[model samples]
Target: MEISLILNNELVWDKEFKSCKEYVSNLKSLAPNEVKMREMEAKFLNLVNTDKDVSKYYKIGGALCISLLTNTTFAYADTLGGVSDKLKTIVSPLIELLAGLGYPVTYGMLITGFIMVIMGKKSKGIDIIKWACIGYVGLQFVPFILNILELIGRELRNSL
Candidate 1:
């Protein structure tokens, strides 16, 4: 009888076997380390799955990286071995929209500070300094609000 097992969307095993138990026992005898490694992997996966904050960070980080790559005109799709063009396009626009909302203000302040220093406006640079400080402080709030809104938008889009 032939049995098959798929892992990570790949056909990892497909062969004739007398019995599942025998196959397992043979695997255990032949590759004890493999079994132990698989068990450890499963435990780690379970831990990640149970941790809501960790999962959220993973999702957000992945989305942010993809967005950053797309916005910066990098070949993110090709790098990932050609992920769907639609997904690449979607991430690019979402990143642009988020940036358009207010992100540029933060960068603008930093640029202004640099320009003020270069223009020999040592005393007037205080204003740019203050703006940079405010922008840094505002960053803490911006990410939280944007994350919440992104979540809501994703939910609404999925619902539709």
Candidate 2:
């Protein structure tokens, strides 16, 4: 009866849903006056599916709602930009580190592992160690094996 939605590794909404169609119909009904709110909610849902940070979406959506209520666009214009800027700042450091390593594949795998670990921790409580271990094995170990094969291929090419 209760549907739980984990957004950005945090529990955003957990409530009972009678039926999926009914829920969607209710959402559609809310779209007329609060179109921005609906847009933000939909975006938030999509971000959750993609394992992205939903906090940024919440901030942007909140700001947009305030703008709609007050008939003031200028005040929240920079706020929307700020959300994007903050996201860039958050990702830039990791990207730079990955670039510096020259083996971005490993870094990308590590990032995926980290995100999975975070999500596991949030959803499953303190027992996230098991989830993290699984993620590491799947992401890191699989790629490491592939990298070894790639190295062997390069060596064979050089010999030929």
Candidate 3:
């Protein structure tokens, strides 16, 4: 289970190869494809599974994973409240700019597109209309998308 435990083991080094010269010639008193090799492997696995140190190793690993998840959960627990407030403060100017400049431009595009269509520029008008629709939806629907994400976060936090 641990490096020190295996390094201190004498039989392992004795049975294992030392170098190229010893590897080709030495067999550690055991023939190639010995009958008991499979049984030895199975028993070694069984021993490892039942070992006290191995249990401790698994317990430590599980504890570390749980600790990490718990810490991360706590770290992001206020994502929809405290973090959101700070993020809102940081992004307020951008939101204000979008509201102040984006809607009027989109509305102008829509009206221009309508006029262009009536004047026989169908393709250009359609493209302008499409872009105006996209802009309008981005301005209006983005908050709903954000709310959905906040709801999902709240559910996960509650379940945890």
Each candidate's lDDT (Cα)? 0.73, 0.66, 0.78
Candidate 3 residue-wise lDDT, 1-160, digit = tens: 1232245555343243367667666665457575688889888668768998976876677777998988743233564567878888899899888777778898899999999999999999999999899988887877788889988987887898
| lDDT for predicted candidate 2 compared with the true structure | 0.66
Q: Which ten contiguous residues of candidate 3 have the minimum total lDDT?
A: 1-10
Clashing pairs in 2: none
Candidate 3: Cα lDDT at 142 = 76
Highest TM-score against the true fold, candidate: 3
Ranking by lDDT: 3, 1, 2
Off by over 4 Å in 2: 1-129, 137-143
Candidate 2 per-residue lDDT over residues 1-160, each given as its tens digit? 8889999999999988678899899898877657888899888678867764566776678888998998887533455336756876798788567545544554465556567667765444333445545554565465468568767876776687
Native-to-model Cα distance after best TM-score fit, residue 46 in candidate 3, in Å: 42
- In candidate 3, which residue ranges exceed 4 Å CA deviation? 1-81
Candidate 3 CA-lDDT value: 0.78
Write down the RMSD of all candidates, one decimal each: 21.3, 29.2, 13.0
Q: Estimate each model's TM-score.
A: 0.25, 0.18, 0.41
